[model samples]
Target: MSQQLIQGNEACARGALAAGCTFFAGYPISPSSEIAELLARELPPRGSVFIQMEDEIASMGAVLGASLGGRRAMTATSGPGFTLMQEHLGYASLAEIPCVVVDVMRGGPSTGLPTSPAQGDVMQARWGSHGDRATIALAPGNVQEVYSLTIEAFRLAETLRTPVAVLYDEVIGHMREGVVLHEPTPEELGRRTAPRAAFSPTFLPYEPDENGVAMLPDFGRGYRFHVTGLMHDERGYPTSDHVKVAELLERLERKVEPAVAAVPPERYRLEDASVVLVAYGIVARTARAAVDLLRREGIRAGLLRTRLLWPLPAPALTEVSSSAELVVVAEMNRGQWALEVERLAGGKTVLAPYLKAGGSVITAEELAGHVRRLAREGVAVS
Candidate 1:
């Protein structure tokens, strides 16, 4: 293990390298440019490929191409660039091309904030692209988690045969922290499942194994197959068959279900508490601190910091919130994820939101005060 003080963006870049990523394609964007910058400096020296594409769309295309060619590929961008890559992201989902995308979230609908931090991209990461597809998104609250989760993103992408997203706010992306970087063991560095039999005309490239994941072959491995954005059959050819299309979508979502358990939420002080706070990314750091402050005030407040953003972690969330009288979903956005919590929450618990958008972070003092007032009044605080 090696300890060093490094920026979260730099940690993400290093994590990519540690995950055996050999190709990177991205356009420089604020809050996320450091990732591309660091990879450009480090990748070539390590005999890996790094390219600055003309735009986010092209960058995603290049990454898909590289991944198909049997390379661990990735890209990094902020909100605006991430929007442009949505089309390609959808394609990757349907085609089952394993890749990683790092979104160092700023604020946005359209370039809302360049340098400031925000958690507005939570919903976008899961639903920005068209169609009904499953998404695997990881949120890291600190620099150390940024490094570790970046590697986990690649591991999930490879093993599940899908694109994985690593999301963190600008605060975590640029914040400096002392991180103990550990090299992943062989088991930690998962491999993409390959076809068991020799490729031939009868081979179905999209045929799923017992795990519901398709064994996709590398492009130049003499396994000729189609790769398209349209719904595909077992042979990887375009298909409009209603049964096959429905099955494809169902299988796509079912295969990624393992991620819910793979990346569980961090339950803090929730053992016996009446008030529960929920948060993720940089906001989770503040929420954790707020729990301590509330506890000191005899508020019996606890926290549920989620690292896995997608697939909802419904079971864990339901179990935790069920025991609490109040569940406060705090975030640095206009209640994006709070909506999900509301949906999953039982009727017994009162759900409140602590939302602050426009690039400002939710402070511990602010969150603790809200919880304190809510506890006294026995009502939801906006």
Candidate 2:
């Protein structure tokens, strides 16, 4: 465990290598191109494979192919590119393929800011694929967390056999800082227990257990099976029947959700403050600094930095929401996570957003100013 200064995006690339990633395929895009560049140079020489795909769509399809080939694979992209990959993300979900996706989110609807930072994809990462599936999006505020969280992303993807999103804003992605890369203990490493039939001459391609997770045969393992963008049965065969579709989709979602509570949650300055603040991604880092700034100025405030964005950290939220004088939710989007909190909220908690879609980073000073105003108005922090 040694400390080295690295950009957040580059840290993610190295983290991928450490997490046993053997394949990299992506179309280069702004703010995230460093990752592609780093992987391209490093992976091939190390016996891993890297390819720059023609586009984001093919980039994702290639990920599926690689993962099925028994490689821990990944892809990196910003907003526009992520949008193009959404269709295939849904396919990975329906087919229950395992892969990690690093979405260093930038501003967006179209060609929003190419180089600027924004948390606009918070909601998209979870609900983007045109269905009710929940996504595991890990938002990191700093470069160090970017590397550590990415390794966890890969483990979670393999654990539940779902595509996990390592979501970060451009601030974290572009910022340079010392990252102490992890050296996971043998016990901590979560290697996929590849089926023994892998060495057998013949095997069931989609053989599943009681957990509904099937043992996938990697592409070159001589285990041939069909995969598709359409809903598939456990056998990976296409199905048009409504019952089969519903069953497959439900299993796909539950294979993750039932135990999502075990996912890590980061609780910051929110221990005793009546008015709690909540934010994620790079925005959460700003929110924390604002918390400290407001405290020194005599505003009793705290923060709940959301690391696990998908499960919403419901119990922890309800606990804080019940006691706070008011709570403020901020993000790059228009109250998406705030809406989730509002539903679970148990008090007179108020929602305030220093929200913006202009493809810029929300500064600690900007958030502090809002806290000062709230403190002055006595508007309530519960």
Candidate 3:
């Protein structure tokens, strides 16, 4: 439990250790490879497992496999690797496995920039895995956040009995900043409760207690419950019945939505604003700096820094945007998460996209200029 200057990637690895992650399976890719390198060396000594699979596909498969074995598991990857993991992600979602996936987004439609930073995968992290099932994700704005959010990811996964994503840009993924490493406090929240006892001769996997989070039984713990990606009933048996599918999906979503009440993030400063910038990850941090400069210049602009990217936090954003005359979204990628914001905000708000491609950072100076230019021209973002 100490603070030190560390890279975001290292913070993520250390955060995993603190979050009770005992298994990691990853494929080396830019931006996120450092997390793997550090964990490979760090985890074994701590009685954890680190695996580098042949590719991102197997990397994802291994983590899911390990999670079933009663270990807190994780995986890290960049955009390409993340893209490849979509199928397994869907599997993790449907199977209701508890684990974390950290995606350090680099610029890309496909390998657009390896060593650069981008927030291109914001939408993908939420919906890239094909399904109607809700996925939760967190976007960290700094190195310390990478540490904190990784723990949150696992906590959400275990509590909801679902896979969760920790979203980061290459900048936050690689940038060196101060981080406080420590074990999560009991009051900090954590994993879902497992079954007190193993299954009987007839075991049911989909049976959930009052909260709707099914008790996850550890594989080979004398528990013989069958798990499959197909839609299943409370008995864990494949159910083609319409009522079974409807009920299963409803339970999956309900388990997560209730947990959001405990994971509120900073609003930055949207208290009384005419114009606001909605941002996440590194761009949000830079945008925070930009907002300060705007305030100093007497502009009533504010920032909405999202800690929770998925589940979208619609209620909070709607409340913040309601006070704004216009909302500008800054991201390293072209309006990915911004689109989601727009959908949630409806048409009551103006929209401007400060988008960048390839690999780069959206500096405070650049954002300040954008705010000034738009304000001077009286051009509402649309």
Per TM-score, the best of the predicted structures is 1
Which stretches in model 2 have alpha-carbon errors above 4 Å?
193-212, 220-224, 258-262, 346-348
Per-residue lDDT tens digits of candidate 2, residues 1-382? 6789999999999888888889999998988999999999999999999999999999999998888777888999988888888888888876767888888887777887788887888778877888877567778778988887788788878867778888888888889999998876543446554555654434554556566666665566556677776766656677798997887767666677633465555677666786678888778887888888888876677888777887567777887777777787878865678778888884446656567668777778988887678767878642
Provide the RMSD of all predictions against the true structure, rounded to 1 decimal: 1.5, 2.6, 2.0
Q: Is candidate 2 or candidate 3 better by lDDT?
A: 3
Candidate 3 Cα RMSD (Å): 2.0
Show model 1 residue runs off by greater than 4 Å. Answer: 380-382
**Candidate ranking (TM-score, best to worst):** 1, 3, 2
Task: Give residue 90's lDDT in candidate 1 (0 to 100).
Answer: 92
lDDT of 1 by residue, 209-274 (tens): 999999989998888888888898999899999999999999999988888989889999988878
Looking at model 2, report the run of 10 residues with the lowest lDDT sum.
Answer: 193-202
Cα-based lDDT for every prediction: 0.91, 0.78, 0.84
Q: Please name the candidate that would achieve the greatest lDDT relative to the true structure.
A: 1
Candidate 3 segments exceeding 4 Å error: 187-189, 196-198, 379-382
How much is the lDDT of residue 268 in candidate 2?
73
Per-model TM against the reference: 0.98, 0.91, 0.95
